[model samples]
Target: MKKLQLSLLLMVFLVMAGCSQSETTNTEVNKLKETNKTLIEDYNKLVDKKEKLEMELDTYKEVDENSKHLTTIIDDFIHAAQKGDTATMQANISKEFTFEKQEEWLTAVNGEKNFPFYSDFYKTKLKSWYLQGIDYDKEKDFVRVFARVGYSDGEDSWYFEIIKEDGYFKISDLQYET
Candidate 1:
């Protein structure tokens, strides 16, 4: 009887030990599952952030390309004016192109009537000229180009407003800083 009692106690201890170990393993498994869930959530958030950044990058690229193209147009317009090429200037300018100063606006009836004066003004008045930069207002569909114009008196900055019309960019208005 004594031996049987000892054996039963040993068996009970072994079963209790087994149960304790199983409970510990289950707890560890639950913690691991929770950690995995949190990691997956973090990964998803990172993926979303990456996608957003990529889209922003694409938008910037498009804007940069547009700015570059507009800059080229401005350069070509200037070159045409310098060469006294009325046809090129007329082609690049909007039909509604206007000269704006202070609060006053002036428009020509047509390019042929107006370009000669502009050609003379640029050639004689502006001793030297260069493009500084170009910016776009997407909502307004307007491009503002900054230029440094050198005159006999001094140098001045000018803003040229370019607008999109009929799927082409055209110089709409020119403004000089006072």
Candidate 2:
């Protein structure tokens, strides 16, 4: 009877041990599944962020390119003006040119009487030009630039109206202000 009782106790112990081990394994498997799900979610979020960053980078590149091109246009205009390349200057000027001192300049060139020193004016008054601002629309072929004309004694601000005609950029008009 003792032997039989001992064997029955050993059998019960073995069965309980097996059940506990199985439960532990099931819990570990569930934990692994949950970890895998979290990892997958995190991976997806990273991919989404990467894609958004790439899109933003592309947009920035485009904007940078446009800005560089606009700067080039401004530089070219300033170069032309500083060199007094009339052909180039006239090409870019709007159809009409306006100046607060337009009549004075014209009258000086026209040899009008009492128009203040004539030949000396042309030799000393016209000086360098500086580009102050440039703006353009990507969809439109027009760019507006603000420039400062440096003379012997003072600087004057002018606006250059730019447009693309027949695949060439030209200044359509010149305005003293506004």
Candidate 3:
């Protein structure tokens, strides 16, 4: 009877030990699952950030391409005017281009009155003019070109404003620095 009692106590201890081991294994599995969930969440956030950066890069590429094309157009127009090519100059001028003069105040000259002024300016002031630099404003959809202009007496700097219209870039305005 004592031997049988000892055997039963040993069996009870073995079963309790097995139950404790199983509980410990279950706790470890729960911790692993929680870690895996956090890693997946972190991976998803990184993927989202990468996608957003790619989209922004694409937008900047498009803007850079457009700016290059517009710069070429401006260069061609300046070259044509320098060579006294009226047809090319006229082609690059937008119909909506306004000829404005501001000495003390601003005044909009009629096209009929403006043509002669433009002609004289191009023929005389722009004879030795050359483009120095160009800047673009994507949000405003406009370009600013810096040029070295030659006057009859001396040389100076000038700026031209170009705008996009009907899928083409055209000279919209000119401003000379005093």
Candidate 4:
């Protein structure tokens, strides 16, 4: 009878230990599920943040492709103008511009007496120039670009009219504020 009692006690102890281990396993599983849920939530938030950043980056581009191209052309033209490079300037201008201002456009660096209407452009060296804005004239079918040029004398407003020719943009006319 003593041996039987000893066996029963051992079995009871084993069963209780097994129940305790099972409870501990269930708690560990719950903790792992919570950790996985937290990781997923964090990942989703990061994705949302990334998407927002991309959209903000797009908004920073104020100029479209066409306008951007026009800006580049104007910048190049200004650089050429500073050096009185008639060839480079003419390359950016339209044939009509060349035809309209034939003598002045071709012989801007000839002499003081024969200087172009904007003689100061070829005489006084410029400091800097900045693009103010660009607007499209729907009815006129042209893009009007405004800029400010700073020279040794002072600042002047510059206007450039860009027109589409042969599927490309060209300077139809350009003048400065007197």
> In order, how many clashes per candidate?
0, 6, 0, 0
Best by lDDT: 4
lDDT scores in order: 0.69, 0.59, 0.66, 0.73
Worst 10 residues of 4 by lDDT: 106-115
Residue 73 in candidate 1, Cα distance off native in Å: 4.5
Q: TM-score ranking from best to worst? A: 1, 4, 3, 2
Per-model TM values vs. the true structure: 0.54, 0.43, 0.48, 0.52
Candidate 2: tens digits of C-alpha lDDT, residues 1-178: 9999999999999999999999999999999999999999999999999997797666556545565554555556555554454455445444344222343342112223211212224654556766687665445545677877677767767775567556655556445431
Clashing pairs in 2: 92-171, 93-171, 94-171, 94-172, 94-173, 95-172
RMSD for all candidates, in order, please.
7.0, 10.7, 6.8, 12.4
Once model 2 is optimally superposed onto the true structure by TM-score, how far is the C-alpha of residue 158 displaced, in angstroms? 13
Cα lDDT, model 3, residue 50: 100
Candidate 4's residue-wise lDDT over 1-178, tens digit each?
9999999999999999999999999999999999999999999999999997786554334235567789888988877776656677777777564422444453332222222433333577679888999977655767889999888888888788888777777887777774
Error (Å) of candidate 3 at residue 122 is 11
The residue-level lDDT of candidate 4 at 96 comes to: 61
Q: What's the residue-level lDDT of 85 in candidate 1?
A: 58
Error of 2 at 105 (Å): 21
Q: Which candidate should be chosen as best, given TM-score against the real structure?
A: 1
